[model samples]
Target chain A: MRRFATLALALLALGAGPRSGFETMTPELQAMQRDDFANPGMLWVAEGEALFQRQGCTGCHTPAQMVGVAARYPVFDAGRDGPIDLAGRIAQCREQRQGAAPLPTESPEALALAAYVANQSRGLPLAPDPDPRLDPARRQGEALFRERRGQLNLSCAQCHDDNAGRRLAGSAIPEGHANGYPLYRLEWQGLGSLRRRLRSCMVGVRSEPFPPDAPEYLALEAYLAMRARGLVVETPAIRP
Target chain B: MRAACAALLLWAAPVLAQPAAFQVVGDTIPASLTGTPGDAARGRAIVTTRQRGLCLLCHSGPFPEEPFQGDLAPSLAGAGARLTKGQLRLRLVDGRRLNPATLMPAYYSTEGLVRVGRAWQGRTVLSAEEIEDVVAFLVTLQE
Candidate 1:
């Protein structure tokens, strides 16, 4: 019975869910995220709103139509044979539906447009669909998250899971959830995507980063979205 | 004939003293490398700097003068007394071999890594000399 109790306790520890990075921010940074007018990320949302109409997205979908849509992204697209995030979906619409060229990943327009779309879902809980097809991708992402690589020999779990809230260098380590992506980072001084952040983390570990739309990144995105399923979307949020 | 033999022995002495390439035996490295001795002062410089070894980023030490020492990993205040030189060398070479999930970077290895930037590919995080230097410095932290 003692052995059984120990096993149960270990399982409980393993199941502990992740926390939002917002909780780890300084009070001043939290305040920056609260006030939309003062938030620099709002600038990208505003730019994205303009792009929505100029790019003819307004013809089929208004801002209200996009509400709560961002919360269900990184869904498996059978046509594409894999998962695609909101950013990829936007690029697809531009190419297939609007007849416009696909926006380059990480471009200002891409950041702005994604920010705008993500903004419509602000305050909604992330609810990625549990498509069975996504299970394989999710598994792969879980593997990637735990796999140690790079010169540092560190996995995402090493910092975000096992040592969350610990300090690395001078900065406090967060759980690394993707709830508030396309966030305005004080360091970047501009809007950035979750993929951009992931790329930076890859570089931090001295690992080569996969390209913007690589399957590995997509897989990682799929897992992050699933991991933050219950967290409220805080799109265009501020981060230090 | 005796004088010639003495001269030959003298010439071979320095070459024989050269440090051999590192070899891992299980988790611990053998103590005493065969190369030029490391400078503790140079090792201290590497540990404290962010652009180099950046050891202070995770591991704290007795350097009260350094304002931003981190507190993530174990403190290095008395590492010299706690671990032998061979153990320190192994940790610096590839810590993951000892604990498969260590967050410490392999300061002097170039294998089984992914996505290494173009400018840094095929290069270890630290040269063998740097590793020896760091080991020398770490072994001095007796208190």
Candidate 2:
């Protein structure tokens, strides 16, 4: 009987195309995401704009120049032998170009910059760099997504794929897309990185998570970007 | 050897279920860990509690008071009608023996688990008596 239910849900998933987590949120949340002034993440965007001027970023490039950069990220970095997301690129630029220290993951400064940069790309479609080099990392990310781990022995695909629209208690499981990240999660009551979100999930299943900035996270983000291709960016997206 | 250990422990130890200390035979354990029975009332509390059993996180049961119940796996509404007491016992102990890809956790075993949260390490999700109590309550869930 359980097999039959799984099979039915699988069939239902087949009929549904890739959907965003935004579509799963309540009406109140949707309204909050729609109104820029009401969205708490805009606060970070404002802070980041100030930091850009104070840190001399505005001297090198205007705010308009950074537009759409977030849409084509998790790029293959030949030097690192891995992919680097938009947030990583920011830190790299600060270190290599600006001669500054690296920002810790999900630090207030890091999230602020990520929100500011990503905010520019809002409404732009995710177009992951299709470099031939990224193929290996993308495949690795795909494998990791399907592989079962933790004491629960559940894979990411099991819930996100098989039961995309089903309720896991009170909340509906979104398709696990990566379009709206660096967004505010009410549960966290603050902004967070996608890696932070993924780690929470790993721990949720009683699994050990990779260290911060692990290649596995880069690979997964790259894979998710590829998977969520054409989906419009919703940086600083509000989530429940 | 395992059976001898089970026999020796049944006589020597007061607490029968000692965290991954039960022996398996075929698809079932075939005997109660305590050599007696468990409290169904206590078992119901464990199943309903969010922090302990976490059963409602995936399996909805006959509890009407709990407004939030998961639909991830099969419903436990008629678990007693669907599975025997021994079958249910095996599942609560570790469903991986039946299906390696199962999302269900081994409520009583701690071996082979990687990166268990610090607070949850070195202990089972439930004690032997708790398992028996849960089993007792489930068997009563004939509907």
- The residue pairs found clashing in candidate 2 are none
Candidate 1 runs further than 4 Å off = A1-16, B1-20, B24-27
Model 2 stretches with alpha carbons more than 4 Å out? A1-15, B1-18, B111-114
Q: Give the best candidate by lDDT.
A: 2
In model 1, what lDDT does residue A67 have?
Answer: 94
Q: Residue A186 of candidate 2: its Cα lDDT? A: 85
- What tens-digit string does per-residue lDDT give for candidate 1 at A1-240? 243245346646889544788988889989889899888898999999999999999889988999999999888898988898899999999999989877878899998999999999999999987787987788788789988866566788888877878877667778888988899877777888998888777766766778655799888888888777778899888877
How does each model score on lDDT? 0.78, 0.79
State residue A70's C-alpha deviation in candidate 2, in Å.
0.8
Model 2 interface CAPRI class: acceptable
